[model samples]
Structures are given as C-alpha cells and as structure tokens.
Target: MTSTLILGGRRSGKSARAQALASTFAEVTLIATATASDGEMAERITRHQADRPAHWHTVESPLYLASALQQADAAGCCLLVDCLTLWQTNLLLAEDETLLARETDALLAILPRLQAEVILVSNEVGWSIVPESALARRFADEVGRLHQRLAAACQRVELVVAGLPLTMKNETGTR
Candidate 1:
C-alpha cells in the first residue's frame, strides 16, 4: 500500500490533484469530511459532488475517519480523503473533549497499515496570520504537528500552490 499526503492553500487545486491521482485506479472511494453548515458551503459541497465520477463511492466521514477508512480499504483499491482540515474542525467543535486526541491517534496508527492506495488532502494553514482566538491558535499548532507525523508515514508528499503541485517527497515502489 502507498499513502500520499497532499497539502495546499485554499483553492490551490490540491483536492483536484488528489482526485486526478485517484482516477488512475479502477476502484475508488472518496471520504468527504466537510459538512454543509451554511447555504454557501452546501453549494460548494454540491459542486464538488458534481465533479466526481458517479460510480466512485463516497463515504461521509466526519469524526470516525479511521473506522471509515478501515471499512473502505481494499487491496488494489484507491481511497481519497478530500481534506483533513474540516475533520479537525469537526473534532474541535464537538462536545466530546477527547475526540480529537482519540481520533488523531487512531488515524495515525492506521494509515501505514491500510491496504489501499490512500491519498489525503489537507490545507497548509500555518502560512496565514496568527489567529486571534486561542482555539484557532491551538488548531494551527495541532494541525502543523499532525502534518509532520503524516509526512513521515506517507510514502509521497506534495504541496500544491497556484494550481500546481510540487513534489515534496516520493517513495513510491520503494516498499
């Protein structure tokens, strides 16, 4: 199994790049984490849905991402997770105080063992100005650290900007 991590700023085409890569596989399952909390977001989600192939399976994974991945994984299949930042947001806003730590640990533990070709998309949010709220700052810190760990686990890592993807590390076919 090969795992890839794709990071980029908003609208930088990281999700599109992930989608294109996953398209190489015959079987694909997309794990969508964002929730349509507002009308604008609902429209964005709809547009994304319209972009994907109808036959490609999609799993709405808000909190239990590891479990969702585990259930969807299959040898020779491709699993595309279209943004970890929203997943982080969901955990942070949830009532369960320990949800973030628990799920984070679970995902970290499971990534390397998954049998499918896994592509994870996340925003590189540390580039922006420091957030005003303590919660936002905490999120920045936590996500930055999580990116580091994910990079180590992933065989390939990419950074997309201005609709271009720059390979950060690639270890495909090495294992």
Candidate 2:
C-alpha cells in the first residue's frame, strides 16, 4: 500500500486533498471517523456526505478503526480515512484510557499489512497554544504523538495549510 498522511488544522483542505488522491484510484472506500452527536455535527456530516460521489463506499467507524480498515482494504482500491483525531476522541471517550494506546498501536501495526492505497487525514492540533482543559490538552498531545508515528510509517507526509499542500516527506527523504 502507498500510505499518505495529510496533517492540517481545521478547514485546511485536508479532506479535499485526500478525496482528490483517492479519486485517482479505480475504487474508493471512505472510512469516516466522525459521528453526528449534535445538530451542528449532523449538518456537517450531511454536507460532507453530499459532497462525496455516490459511487464511493462509506464506512462509519467512530471506533474500531483497525478492524474497519481490515474489512475495507482491498487490492487496487483506495482506503481514505477521513480524520484520525475524531477516531482518537471516540476511543478516549468510549473505553478506558489504555484503550487509546492499544487501538493506536493496532492501527500502526496493521498499516503495513493493508493491501489498499491508504490516505489518512488528521488535524494538526499541536500548532496552536495549549488548550485550557486537561482533557483537551491531553488530546492534543496524543494527536501530536500519533501524527509523528504515522508520518514515520507513511511513505508520503503532507502538511496542508490555506488550501495548499506542502510535502513534508516523500519516498526520497523527509522534507
């Protein structure tokens, strides 16, 4: 699998970039990690769903991301994981604190085995000032660490800002 990790702040065009890359494949399976827990979230989810092509398969996996990838992965297909931060939140809220590390470890371990082209979108939470709340701070720290680990595993790493993508790492070397 040709793995690419897209990191950016909110509204940085990470999803759009991932979608464009995935569209180049013959088949696409989108592993959506977001859930509509409230009205605004529902609206956002609806908008995203509408934006996607009807032919692309969507899998709602607020948790159990590794299993979702295992099931959706296929040769000659692209598996686009839209936002890993939400997945981390899901794991942090749904299970014991240890679950986050366990699930993240599983995801990293499974990446090498997946047969599909993998494009993962993640928020760059560490770029801003430290969050006020303890939980928020912890989330930011975990997400930052996760991005570092993912970048190491992925063949391509990009930082999207102002709707532009800056290649940080490629097959040749780390940019």
Clashing residue pairs found in predicted model 1: none
Q: Candidate 2, which segments miss by more than 4 Å at Cα?
A: 172-175
- Which pairs, if any, clash in model 2? none
Candidate 1 regions with alpha-carbon error over 4 angstroms: 173-175
lDDT for residue 152 in candidate 2, whole number 0-100: 98
Q: What is the lDDT of every predicted structure here?
A: 0.94, 0.92
Best by TM-score: 1
Q: What lDDT is reached at residue 144 by model 2? A: 88
For model 1, what is the C-alpha lDDT against the true structure?
0.94
Per-residue error at 10 for model 1, in Å? 0.3
lDDT of 2: 0.92
TM-score of 2: 0.96
lDDT of 2 by residue, 66-168 (tens): 9999999899999999989999999878748788998999999999999999999999999789899999998999998999999999999999999999999
Q: Summing lDDT over every window of 10 consecutive residues in candidate 1, give the lowest-scoring window.
A: 166-175
Each candidate's clash count:
0, 0
Q: Which model scores highest in lDDT?
A: 1
lDDT of 1 by residue, 1-175 (tens): 8999999999999989999999999999999999999999999999999998999999999899999999999999999998899999999999999999999999999998899999999999999999999999999998898899999999999999998989999889542
